[model samples]
Target: MLSWVDGRPAELLSVRDRGLAYGDGLFETVAVRGGRPALLERHLARLAEGCARLGLPYDATVLRDELLAFSRQLGEGVAKLILTRGDGLRGYAPPQPAVVRRLLLGGARPAYPAEHAEQGVRLFPCATRLAEQPLLAGLKHLNRLEQVLARSEWQDDEHAEGLMQDASGRVIEGVFSNLFLLKGGVLLTPDLSRCGVAGVMRAELLAQADALGVPCEVRDIDLAELLSADEVFLCNSLYGVWPVRRLQGRDWPVGPLTRKLQAIARDLLDC
Candidate 1:
């Protein structure tokens, strides 16, 4: 993997970097298409929001220019942007004048089976439950231990993803993506006000549904409601949209609404 540190090419990352020291950083995984980063604006916006929430200094224009230049050289693949509070002396307290280190890495594109998209994916209900922290919720920060544990629950290749619930036993979202269910001809997604990452594709789908005159709601989703839903799907920037063929022992159809949303996402991503 090729990498750039603080605007210069580097072979190895410093062990002292606060990102490694305290997970004190934010990272973004972007898909490169035709030498351009997909959803560049939305990705940058989320990055900036994360930095602001952490009280870190950032220059969006510089970051954008660097990412674009780096991505162009990659041709087509995944581009990862990592920004961390620079090295600091021993202590839990953050450095007053925090120095920022930015790293960009490029690598091979991810491969997803074409059959999964055509037929649909299977999901397992995870035992791990996300903690409620409104202040830290909805931001893609570096602290992702919850996701790490949730994803480790299953080893079956047939199951494509796992569904996570909140501490109150409310169906929240997937480990790395957002969840949406259709019931009685209405679409529903969990509200991210308390927990879960508010994915960019989820926002786009909501907008498309509004324009298409499809009824949609963002609210707390219970496990019972999810189990009784007519259809369910998962979505993320990288995977586009995936219809869930089965969850636990229950089966779901790849309904018309799912196909309509998938077409919209495919057009937006040009994939």
Candidate 2:
């Protein structure tokens, strides 16, 4: 494993970095194989977009070169890229000519259990509700307290992930991944315009579904709809796709459509 901070090789994060002090940054977790960052283009695009949204400077080409060089050191693993606003003044006010800090941490190979992927995973509804913040939604920002709190609600190792809802009790997504449900032959995923990170894998799946002529919807989802879903799944760039076997005592089949998605994901990730 290897790590670099602020364009220099380092092992420990500075306590004064704005990312640690104020969560003032953005990050992307990418799967690196054979020294290549998977979906590098998409990740860079998202990083640039996040920086623009936060009024930060981001040169994608430079960052790309840095990431390539960093990943080459790891051989194969997960590459976590973080861009922070740097050490700031004592308050929330923005600093003039902010010093941006870039960090690349390595070593996170896919280690999900085979049984969970083959038979599917079990989930439970988390009492935590994601806050509605359109400005921050869809960006993989540093403010992830909601996910941390929701994930902490469960201690059972058998439960792979927990489902979170919006403030209005509308089903949103899993703690660290996107949620998809198949109900009555329709593919439904939460509209992340209001909240939740717009996962790269989820976007790819949606595009695939569109090309394959599968009926798909992006809108508000209710818990009752999820409870009645014929099948459910969670996805992120790292884990690929995982079928949900159970959710709060509700059982689901690893149906044909879910398998089709899995096949596409495998091809995309070269797994």
Candidate 3:
């Protein structure tokens, strides 16, 4: 494990930091290969958007340099970038003239079972439902208690991921990955405008689908739509793509489209 705080090496954070105090921060989990961060531009773009949405001051150039340096030092692994509103006085109100803080942590790449990507995975149906908050939607903010609770609903190895839905039973995503389904030759994913994390890999796949003339749609997906799909898969920046074979007793074969997009995701992460 390695860590950096504001471009300098450190292992501790201020207790008064708003990120710790009130979850006033955004984070990016990046995959590094050969001393470079995969999907660098997309990660930076999301960070920029999050900073603007949260009214935090940021220097994209500085952050980029720090990320590059951190990844180079890490060599090959997963790098997590955390951007916070720095320390603040005791209150819910954000401090004026906030000084942003950047924290980078690196860890070894996860050794996920190859069968997950090769054969496919089963999903645990989580009872915890996501609350709709358009204001905070799609931003990978520090507040992730919802995900924590949902993930805890499962305590076995049969399921590789948990299926999460919004309060209205609309399928949104997996616990730690974005969800996509293929139906009638169309690649469909849940819209993050109302809730859910807008993953970098999801955006990349949608772009690739468009380039390859694969019909792609971003809209609300209900359980029925997902269950009746021709194929299903999950994606995140870390593991690329995992074809979903089972969910709540329903089974789906790893279809051709899933394979095609999975290959694309693998190539993107590899490069």
What's every prediction's RMSD, in angstroms? 1.4, 1.4, 0.6
Largest lDDT belongs to which candidate?
A: 3
Residue clash pairs of candidate 2: none
TM-score of each: 0.95, 0.96, 0.99
lDDT per residue (tens digit) for residues 1-271 in model 1: 8689887888688788888888898888888877888888888888888899888898999999998998888878888899999888777788989999898998888798986767889988899999999987888877889999999999989888899999999999988889999999889999988888988789889989989998999999998899899989988887789999998788989999998998888776653
In model 1, which residue pairs have backbone atoms overlapping below 3 Å? none
Candidate 3 positional error at 92, Å: 0.9
Worst 10 residues of 3 by lDDT: 262-271
RMSD of 2: 1.4
Candidate with more favorable, higher lDDT: 2 or 3: 3
Question: What is the TM-score (0 to 1) of candidate 2?
Answer: 0.96
lDDT of 2 at 133: 95
**Candidate 3 lDDT over residue span 68-183, tens digit each:** 99999999999999999999999888889999999999999999999999999999999999999999999999999999999999899999999999999999999999999999
Model 2 lDDT at residue 237: 89
Give Cα distance to truth, residue 145, candidate 2, Å: 1.3
Identify the leading candidate in terms of TM-score: 3
Error of 3 at 38 (Å): 0.2
